[model samples]
Target chain A: MQITSSLDEIRSIVKAAKKNNLLIGFVPTMGALHEGHLSLIRQARTENDTVVVSIFINPIQFGKNEDFAQYPRMFDTDCELLSKEGVNVVFNPKASEMYPDGFCTTVVPEHLEDKLCGKSRPGHFRGVATVVLKLFNLIQPDSAYFGQKDFQQTVVISRMAADLNLDVNIKVLPTVRDKEELALSSRNAYLSETEKKDARCLYQALIKAKDMVNAGENNAGEIKLEMEKVINNCKSARIDYLSIVNPETLEAVTEVRNGNVVALAVMIGKTRLIDNIILMVLIVCLITLA
Target chain B: MQITSSLDEIRSIVKAAKKNNLLIGFVPTMGALHEGHLSLIRQARTENDTVVVSIFINPIQFGKNEDFAQYPRMFDTDCELLSKEGVNVVFNPKASEMYPDGFCTTVVPEHLEDKLCGKSRPGHFRGVATVVLKLFNLIQPDSAYFGQKDFQQTVVISRMAADLNLDVNIKVLPTVRDKEELALSSRNAYLSETEKKDARCLYQALIKAKDMVNAGENNAGEIKLEMEKVINNCKSARIDYLSIVNPETLEAVTEVRNGNVVALAVMIGKTRLIDNIILMVLIVCLITLA
Candidate 1:
């Protein structure tokens, strides 16, 4: 695998691939790759003639008190895993290279960014959309892979891509989970052994919500209360939000229905982990012949 | 030449051209074509294998009181002009088609969109950037052409394209003017014949500013005073903003120098018009071998 830090080099390489009629697939990551990121890379490799991976921890996405300074950066190990997955080019640009001194353009999604995580973390999706667009322009990918672990992120990106009429297809894969059913995240590195175990409460709460919906309990408020209780069982866990929302719009649904998503964010010790499960109910309707 | 209003048709046409290794050049306009728009199309035709011209009178770029409804849209005549210029295609998507039901994305430039035309027309550049980006994605042009008549627009778009790392080259051609030196604009149709005669004050004021700068008058305030006097010569012209600024940053320059732009927006009766002229001073540096 070729590793490049220069934007010019990567542009030339991607252009050359395009000139040869190569179907380019891209996976954008923030380094410190885990199984979730690796799964995305593996899927990208399967789909395209050339798979390019970008590893830039975009600084604009973090808030004032966010753990941006302490976020994991295991570049060597990440490259090893990516090389194993047969990634064609690894774009590892420095922060300055990605966002030069006078960079000030932003891609903002209206309505979609006013709920859920957007309420707590203002301008987060703005940063994601901006960086994603920059990477999309550089790679000009036929398809881009994203993980469902960051559910809202995938939705935001999808909406932005569609609204902007971007040519690339956005492919979202299922979230990769650990043995404890906790969503694999790079931030999980901040968790201690006990906190790591407690982090599973997020997934457990989502499962509880899903079961309630599956059992025909439609009240969204009731489902959230039960989810909160499941999360409260863990001493280190703090419930940030437990929402049952429309999977596409991210709008709160008072009455849970099929295809509703039950997502949660909880702080387990110093690490804030998030996980979600899509509530699916198979409907059977009896047809009466007139 | 074929004219398409369907986005899907345009995308397929552009894609087929791309597959055949044709270099695409794009010219985005708001129809009502005149010499200014034709110049941009002529440049696009000269440079690329295929030239795609988009004539969309974007509604979002107009404010509540602005003349979006009354904006002249001469599609048949505009297509004739483009066809004569050897244009490969003309994309004229409807407002609903471009901004579908749930379309809610905007591209915003920070410092760049705060002055000049942006001050008078809030959210104008945001709309321009968003629509331009959408068109850029659809056309996938190797280079895009813009007339320098909309000086702030060119700066805002150039900043947005650079910040987002869009692959297309942004080529700015000189502002095409009429016999009376009035900058060509679609809004010119809104003016009465007498008001059209008075509109020459915009270019007259710009020339006055340039003359003042060339005459070793460095003070921006002094230059503006002279420009105001020149523009006031017209009975119908009302000065909106007369600014001497750095061409790239669009920031007001305290003292006039080489590569500075004197841009203005004026209200002639009910119609608004904008014009600018870049000041250039040749500098000679003496080099001696030691």
Candidate 2:
């Protein structure tokens, strides 16, 4: 696998790939690669002739108070893992390369950006959308892979690409989780053993919400109460937001239904962890009703 | 020249052109073709193997009270002019095609968008930047052309392309003018013959500003006053904005200097017209001082 830090080199490579009629798939990440990132890379690998992974710890996405400084950067290990995963190219651009002087333009999505993760971390999705768009332009990928772990992010990016009439396709994969069902994230490295255990409450709450929706509990208020109760059981976990929202619109739904997403964010000690599940109410509710 | 209204077809054609190693140049317009647009097309034809022009009357750029509905669009005449200019492809997408239902994303340039024309027309630059970006993505041009008559627009777009790391080069050609020095614009069609004659105040103001700077007038305030005087002399003209600013930053300059752009917008009867001239202060000031 070839590792490049320059934007020009990546474009040339992408241009050459296009000349040869190779289908390119891109996986954009923030470096500290784990099972979640690997899952996206694997999907890209299986789908295209060329899989390019970008490890940019985007500073603009982080709030002033967020853990940008503490964000992990394990480049050597990440590159080794990607090489083993059969990735063709690894694009690791420096902050200066991605955001040169006089970088003033930003992609802002209205309505969608003001909800979910957007409320807590302002300008986060703007950063994500801008960098992702830049990567798509640079790589000229046929399709780009994004994990469903950052559900709202996936939605925002997909909407931006569609609204902007970008040529690339956005493919979102299911969230990868550990055996304990804690959603795998690069931030997962920040947790202590005890905090890690407590973080499982996020996934547990999502499952409980799913179970309630499956059992004909349609009231969003009732499901949220039950989900919050699960998180409250973990003494170390502090609930940030527990929402049952329409996955695509990210709007809070009064009643749970098929395709609605049950999502939650919680603070386990100082580390913030998020998890979600899309309620397949049609299949499960149909089976129960019958 | 081949005219395609479907975005997908244009992308495929652009893709094929790239495959054949042809350098593509793009010129995006709102279609009532004039000398300014023709100048850009001619430049594109000379420089690129494949020149694509898009005629999209973007609704998002115009304020509710503005002339979006009345925006002149002469497709057949536009096509004839483009064919004569040797443009390879003409992309004329319907408003619905470019902005279908659920089109929610917007590209916004912060400080630059709020100044000059952006001040008078709130969402104008946002619409221009967004549609131009969509065109760049669809065509994937090697370089894109713009007329400098809309000076602030050129700055905003150039800033956007640079900030977003878009692959295409943004080339701003000098504003094309008639023998009377009136900047060519589709909006010129809206003017009555007398109003059209009154509209000459815009270019006349720009010339007066340039002449003032040439005659050793260094104060921006003084030059603006003289330019505004010229526009005020036209009975049908009302001043919208008249200022001397840095050509690149669009920030108002206190003193006129080499490279400062003297830009103005005026409403002649009901039609709004804009014009500008770059001050060559050094040559003029040196001659005056000697």
Candidate 3:
């Protein structure tokens, strides 16, 4: 695997590969390669002639009070893992290189940015959309892989690409989780052992919401209440937001239905962890149709 | 010249051309196709193997009260002109195709969009930036051309391409003018012959500013006053905005200096026309440095 930190070099490499009609897949990540990121890389590897992974923890996406300084930077390990996963190129751009002087343009998705994770972290999705779009412009990948762990992020990026008529396909894979069902996150590194155990409540809460929907409880409020109860039981857990929303629109739904997602964010001590589960109603409908 | 209205077909054509190592140049226009647009097309033809022009009068760029509905679109005449100019492809997409339902993303250059023409037309630069970026993504041109008649627009777009790390090079050609020195514009169609004659005030005002600057009057206010006087002399003309500014930033400058721009917009019988001239100090500096 080739590791590059220059934007020009990576672009030339990708352009040359593209000239030869090779399919390119990109996986953009903030470099503390966990199981979630590895899953995305693995998927990209299986599908394309070239798989490029970018590991820049975009500073613009973090709020002023967020854990940007403390965000993990295990580059050596990250590169080794990516190499093992058969990622053809690893793009590790410095912040200065990514956001050069006089960088003033931003991509803003008007509607989808005000709900779910966007509520607590203002300017977060704008930053995400801008950086992701920049990466897409640089790489010009045939397809980009994203994990469903950051559900709202996936939705925002997909919407931006479609609305802007970007000529790249956005493919989202299912969220990867630990045996305990805690959705893997780079922020998971911040958790103490006890806090890590408590973090499991997020996944449990999502499962609780899913089970309620499976049992024919269509009321969004009741499902949220039961899920909140599960999360509130963890001593170290503090609920930030527990929403049952239309997955695509990110709008709060009054009643749960097929294709809705029960997404949550919680603070396990100082660490904020997010996880979600798509409702089973869609799967049930598919089975019935089959 | 081949005319295409489908995004997918254009992408395939561009991709095939790119594979053959052809340098592509793009000129995006709202298609009344005057000499101003022809100048850009001519420059593109000289510098690239393939020149693609897109005629899209973007609705999002026009304010509700503005002349979006009345925007001149002469497709057959435009095509004839492009063919004569040796344009390889003409992309004339419908508004619905370019911005289908659920088109919600916008590219905004926050600082540059609120000055000069932006003051009179809110969200104008935002729409221009978004559509131009979309076209860049679709075409992936090696170089994109713009006319300097819309000086602030050129500044905004150049800033956006740089900030977003877009791969295409942005090239600004000089504004094309008629024998009367009136800058060619699609909106010139809205004017009656008498109004058209009155519209010469825009170019005349710019010339007045240039004469003042050449006479060593450094005060921006003084230069603007003289320019406005020339424009206000026309009985049918109404001053929209008349100011001298730093060309790159589009910020109002108290005093004219090297690289300052004199930009103005005037309304003649409900038709708005804009014109600008870069200061001679920069030209002198260039000659001295050379």
Write candidate 1's Cα lDDT for B174-215 as tens digits. Answer: 999888999998889998999999999998888887777777
Question: Model 1's DockQ?
Answer: 0.80
Candidate 1: residue A118 Cα off by (Å): 1.5
- Residues A1-290 of candidate 1 have per-residue lDDT tens digits of 99999989999999899899899999999999999998998898989999999999999999999988999988999899988899999998888978888888899988877777888888899999999999999889999999998989999899889989999999999999988898899998899998988888888888888788778888999989998999899999987777889988899999888888888888898777888888887687999999
**Candidate 2 error regions (>4 Å):** A283-290, B283-290
* Candidate 2: tens digits of C-alpha lDDT, residues B1-290: 89999988998999899879999999999899898898898898889999999988889999999998889868999999999999999999888988888677889898888888999899899888998888888898999999889889899999989888888889999988877778888888888889988888888888888788778889988888888789899899999999889877789999877898888889988888998888898662345555
Single out the weakest 10-residue window by summed lDDT for candidate 1 chain B. B276-285
True-vs-predicted CA distance for residue A161, candidate 3, Å? 1.6
lDDT of 2 by residue, A23-96 (tens): 99999999999998998899899999999999889998999999999999899999999999999999999999
lDDT of each: 0.90, 0.89, 0.90
Chain B TM-score per candidate, please: 0.96, 0.95, 0.95
Docking class of 2: medium
**C-alpha RMSD between model 3 and the true structure:** 2.8
B121-227: candidate 3 lDDT, tens digit per residue: 99999999999999998898999999999899999999998888888899998988888888888888888999988988898888888887777789988888888
Global lDDT for candidate 3?
0.90
